[model samples]
Structure formats: structure tokens, C-alpha cells
Target: MRIAMWSGPRNLSTAMMYSFGARADFTAMDEPFYAAYLKATGLDHPMRDAVLAAQEQDPALVPLGFVQDGTRHLYMKHMAQHMIDGFPLDWAEDCVNIHLIRHPARVIASYAEKREAPRLADIGFDRQLMLFERLGGLVTDSADIRADPEGMLRRLCAAIDLPFDPAMLHWPAGPRAEDGVWAPHWYGAIHRSTGFAGPEGELPELKGAEAEVLEAAMPYYERLFAERLKNS
Candidate 1:
């Protein structure tokens, strides 16, 4: 089974990827479309050149190839905004899609610490909602996962018709071969983590433009957050 796990940046996405990677039956894939996103938009992200050189450049073909790569179970970590430029969604029907959402306020604040400037699209809430409606798959929140990793994951597994694997709770530290080339720039904390850390602290303070972006993103976030599976 191939699972297309969609999420925004700074949303425990990598940690969740680590959870899946720990399972003996699954293989986790970091942002398979990062290179395609960069190439398509020419965004100057960290390691832009190296990422572009190392990953597939065609946005259109990347997702197709990812779903076709045979594995007992494949967990694909994806950023919703990468579906830019009218990227097709028909292929997503080929896999079991899941949405990982976080409050816009928390997402913006955590994201601002890494990159000062952020747009609504960069936070990914809007795009994520779009995909959720189109794909109609399981929806989960980062806060819910942090609050109860085992419980939330079990719910997620059951929602998708997979057995809940205890191994999803932890993994060896440091990077794995599946990490995107951008791991060095974004994965510092998770690289040291063995399991879901703890409940996230209060949303960080936001000022000026950051606050505006959060305000604009809240509706989209709420639409999906309301649909998140209830944690037992």
C-alpha cells in the first residue's frame, strides 16, 4: 500500500516520516517533489542547487513515479503547495492520501523562525485543504499526534485500513537514505529525536505581516482541522 502523507512545512512532517520509516513493513520518502517545485518556480531555498541536481526535475512526472515505485508500503511526505501550476490530482487516487494539519498560528510562528518571510502558500494550509477535499482521505493534526502518538497513529492506521504497528512510535536517530537533500537545512531537531517529543507549546507570538498571513490562513486551516479524526 502506498500512503501519500500530505503536510505543510514545520508541521512534524519529518517526525511522522520517521515514525513510518521505523516500521518494518514500510519505506518513507521525503519530499519527492521538492526539486520539481524549485525547478518550476525557481525558489531560492537552502541547498537549491544541490536539491535540484539530486532530484527529479519534472513536477508532473515525480508523483506518478513515486506511486509506482513498488514497496510493501510506501509513506510519501509531501508539501501541498508543490501541487502548484495546476499539477494533476488524478494520480493521487492511486494511493491512500492523508492530510497532516496544524493551526495556522503555530505553523506561521514556527516557520518564521527558519525563514523570516512567509506567504499563505508557503504555510500550505490553503493548498492542504484543497487536496483534502479532492482526495477525501484521513485528516490528522500535529497537536493531536504530539499529545498522543500511539493513540493518534492507531486511529490513523485504522482509518486507512492498516494494522497499527507499535514500531511507528520510535526510530534510530540521525538521517536515513530517504531524506530529501534539504534535510541538513530543515531536520536538525528531528534528527536527534527518537519519538514524538511532547505536546507543542503555545503558539508563538506573531507580529505585523506574519499575523496577517496567519489570519488569512486560518479559515483554510479550520476547514480541515474540523475534520481531523477524533483521538481516542
Candidate 2:
């Protein structure tokens, strides 16, 4: 199976990727389109040069097709915002796409620490909703997963008809072969962990632009959150 996990920045996307990657039958691909995003937008993101160097600069050359020789599965981790204006998304039709969301306030708070000034588009809530509307995939919340990793994951697996692999509950600390080159910049917190973190505390207070972004993102987030898999 080809699993496309769609999420924005600062969400538990990398951790989820690690969770699936821990499974013996899956080969995880981290942000396969990141370099294409950076190249097309020329956004001057951190590690821009390195990311371009490490990944396929030509989006066309990047292989989105699956060649399943046996029972192996491919879990492709994707950032919603990375689907630029001209990017093609027809590839998603063949995969079991899943949307992962976090509260906008938490996403904003965590993102600001990495990028001093962030806008609504930078965090990808808008893009996430767009994809959710079009692709209609299973939606899961990061907060929900953190609160009950095992239960929620089992529920997620059952919903997708995938076996609930116990290996998804934990992973070895540090980076893996599938990590994007930008890992050094954005994966520190996850790299140091063995599994999902505990439940998050209350949302942090925000002001100025951060607060504005949180406001803009809430409607989309709430819509997806409402569609998230029920606790089981």
C-alpha cells in the first residue's frame, strides 16, 4: 500500500512517519517534494541550498509511483504547503491518504520558534483543508494521538484495514534513512525521542501576527478536527 500522510509544519508528522517506518514492512519517504517546493518558490527557507542538493530538484524526476515487489508498503510523508501552484497531485489518487492536524495555536507557537516570522500560508492549514476537501481521507489529530497513541493508532489501522503493528508504538531515537535533509533544522525534538510525547498542555498565549494566524487557521482546523477519527 502507498500511504500519503499529509500534515503541516510543527505537527507530529515526523513522529508518525517514524512510527510507520518502525514497521518492518514499510519504507518511509520524508517530504519527497520538499526540494521541489523550495525550488519552485525560492522561499529562502533554512537549509535551502542543502535541501535542494539533497533531494530531486526536478519534481518530475521524483518517483511517486509504487512498485510493490511483495508485501512491502510505502509511507510518504508530505507537507501540505509543499504542493505549489503548478504541482501535480494526481499521484495521491492511488494511495491511502491521511490528514494529520494539530491545534493552530500550538502549531503557530511551535513554528514561530523556528521561523521568526510566519504567515498563514507558511503553516499549511489552508492547503490542508483544500486537500482534505478534495481527497477526502481519514483525518487524525496530533493531540489525540499523543493522548492515547496505542488506542488511536489501532483505531486508525482498523479504519484503513491495516494491521495494528505494535512496532508503531516506538522507534529508536535519532534520525533514520528516510529523514529529509532539513532534519537538522526541524527534527531535533523528534530525533531525541523514542515515541510520541505525552498529552500537550493548555494552548499557549499569543499576540500580534501569531495570534492573527491562529485566528485564520482555526476554522479550517476545527472542520478537520470534527472529522477526525473518534476515540475507540
Candidate number with greatest TM-score? 2
Stretches of candidate 2 exceeding 4 Å from the true structure: 64-70
Instruction: List model 2 lDDT by residue over 1-232, tens digit each.
Output: 9899999999999999999999999988899888888988889899999999988877776764445537889898999999877687887887898999999899889988997757888989999999999888899999999999999999999999999999999999998988988899999999999999999998899999889888998999999999999786
Each model's lDDT: 0.86, 0.90
RMSD after CA superposition, every candidate: 1.3, 1.3
Could you give me the TM-score of model 1 versus the true structure?
0.96
**Clashing residue pairs found in predicted model 1:** none
Steric clash count of candidate 1: 0
Residue pairs clashing in model 2 are: none
Single out the weakest 10-residue window by summed lDDT for candidate 2. 60-69
Q: What is the lDDT of candidate 1?
A: 0.86
